[model samples]
Target: MPDLATFQREMRKAMVAGGVPSTTLEGAVVSDTLPAERRIRVHQNNYRESLCRALMSLFPVARVFVGEQFIKGVFAKYIAREPPCEAVLSHYGAGLPDFLAEFAPVCQVPYLRDIIRLEWAIHSLQLVEEFGNALSADGTPRLSPNVRLVDSDYPILNLWMAGTGQIPPEAVSLKAGGQCALVTLSGGEVRLAALDSAQRQTALRIEAGEPVEGDSLTMLTEMGAVDFHAG
Candidate 1:
């Protein structure tokens, strides 16, 4: 007989992926309300439902972009492939951006992946506690714990905002070129700012290479996108 830990692991896998395992359940748990398999299914359904809701909360824009039925299908595959490793639901969808990037069915919306990234950043910032100084010894600034930057070849910010119904769709033009976004949360207010050409270039270079040019770094410092303190 499998050890208790091994058996439990296998049982969980079975519950998530299929009907309870064919392996004998000599001492398997039984629910008074239903057979063990049926009871396990109820738990499985609830688990998936919870995760699905979390995903929706994090990526409302993506959900709108893809439509309800399509998002449900995506969530089904997402649940099967990327079971939560963390207990925190807010942290659960960190990989979703990459997952959507590679998911072939979503290719129609090539910018969808970046949209997910933006939403994930928002979701994560709400849960992540701030720490450390936002400034360094060289008078340069570091990124705030709640601050994030992303660049994509699409107007992801406008799309996300419009999808959420926060702004009029007419205000955003899909034909307009790429965008860089600076996301920050301050005093419980979350804001997404569009970056200018220089700022966007600086942000891209910052992520890909080292610090940007001095002037751009200074701009970052001025905008408080860079760290402002050592603590």
Candidate 2:
């Protein structure tokens, strides 16, 4: 008989794909009505469908951007290669953004990777209870626990807005150049703010714990996006 670890590894493979070794399948508790092979298939189907749904929920905008059929096919391919590492379903598709960077089908849609990244950033922040203190000791504003930075060479913000029905699809221009954004969670809702080059630099500086001075900092403070510390 295979060791426990070997048996578990084989079982995992069986759950992911067919071709379960007869020796392994024989260990299943067989009943008169259902055989072990058929039982494993039922579990495999549910496992695959659940993970696929998790990926779809993680990147709803991406699904809208690429149509249900395309996204489903792409995700099905991804699921076959990568399995869940942990129990948390929300965190399952973290690597998908990088996966898309190399996925051949999306080669023409270069921005899809960044869109997944943006969505992942938002999804990740929702799991955090808090980022950190409100401000640095020196009075420089600091990024909130909920703030996430995403910089993309494509007009991903417009694309995301369009995908979410916030704007008309015609409003997005892929040739409009790159865009940067600060994604934050406010009052339990995710918010996106587009930033110019200078503003992006300022935000980056703050993230690095460097002292920064600018109208962007001041405005963010006024908007309660960042808290100002009195020196």
Candidate 3:
């Protein structure tokens, strides 16, 4: 018989990988009378279900765009290709934006990937801000509770706002061009604000792993940032 630690590790692998049972323990091992394979099936279903729920919560607008079947397919592929590495399941769908970019089926809907990226940012910001009490001086919050920065060639703000019922229904024309937005939590509420040229430049600099401070803002302004705000 394998030791307890080995048994647990093997069980976890079998549960996630969907293969023949490796342990000798019967159905009694998993609190079910079904055969080991069936029990494993249940585990598989549970795992996929949990992941789907997480994705849905993070990207409801994306879900609406792709519909149910396509989303299920995406979730299935995501689980098989990129299983959760960290204990926190919120981080599981972080790769979804890149996946959508490469996914051939949704290539025509280019804005879809950017929309998912925005949603993921919001989800992550909410989780992080909830845990840390980081605050700026004079009681002014430094990082918004939800960090939703949009860096896309597509009009993600319009699509997201339309999906969430913030924009009028008739205003959401498919032909609308691309735009960038920043979703942040201000005064304990989530707010989606449009990003100006300067902010976009700053975001680009920060995303490139460059330090964004005084000189960076100056460079951004020189690079054609019409209306720069000091935040």
Candidate 4:
């Protein structure tokens, strides 16, 4: 009889790899009319099913872009290559954007990877349990968590909006160009807003890990940002 540790290791390998030594699970430890390989097959199917469902929830827009058949194919390929490490499914697809980028089949859709990144960000923001105190008394929010506001050239906000169906279908022209965006959480809701020059400067400073005060406001005014309130 294989020890518990060795049995667990072989089971994991088979669960993710679909092929383990048939005798790995052979022993009198457990009763079974079914062979060990057949039992392992059941586990593999369950793993695939759970992983596909998790991916579907995380990347609905990607699923829409690629039909169910294609998505299933991609998911199967990805799962066989990359299995879950953490207990939480939310973190499972963190590398999906990179995976999609190198995937030969989806090379035609260049924007698909970026869209996946946006979806991942949205998922992460939703999962974050604590946020910095950045709102004003009037209910307007401020960007207070370092300088994440001014980071990234990807127009991530628009990309996220487009992916999640928050933007109008007709308005979603991929070639329409990028825009500066402000991302914030308020009253348990995530909000995205366009940023003007001043806000952008302030956001830059915040992102650069600089101190904010009167001087930041002056720079923001020069950039045509009259509103410093968070969105």
When summed lDDT is taken over every stretch of 10 residues in candidate 3, the lowest stretch is 220-229
lDDT value, residue 52 of candidate 4: 91
For 1-231, candidate 2 gives per-residue lDDT tens digits of 577887778778787765453566557536458767777777778888888888988889998878888988788878887888889888788878777777899987788899988999988878877644476566767876677888899887888899899999999998899888788777677788888887877778877888888798876655445666857
The residue pairs in collision within model 4 are 141-230, 147-206, 147-207, 198-220
Query: How large an RMSD does model 4 have?
Result: 6.1
Q: Tens digits of per-residue lDDT for model 4 on 9-125?
A: 877776787764446564523547977566667777898988999998888887766678888888888988898888888888988877887899987766667667666665666
lDDT of each prediction vs. the true structure? 0.76, 0.79, 0.67, 0.64
The best candidate by lDDT is: 2
Over the full model, what C-alpha lDDT does candidate 1 score relative to the true structure? 0.76
| Candidate 1: segments with Cα more than 4 A from true spot | 1-3, 25-35, 131-133, 137-141, 228-231
lDDT of 1 by residue, 158-224 (tens): 8888988988989988789888889877767677889888887776665554555567766776665
- Runs in model 2 deviating more than 4 A are 1-6, 17-22, 26-36, 130-133, 138-141, 208-211, 223-230
- Displacement of the residue 195 alpha carbon in candidate 3, Å: 2.1
What C-alpha lDDT does candidate 4 achieve relative to the native structure? Answer: 0.64
Ranking by TM-score: 1, 2, 3, 4
TM-score of each: 0.85, 0.83, 0.72, 0.69
The candidate maximizing TM-score is 1
What are the per-model numbers of colliding residue pairs? Answer: 9, 1, 2, 4
How many pairs of residues in model 4 come into backbone collision? Answer: 4
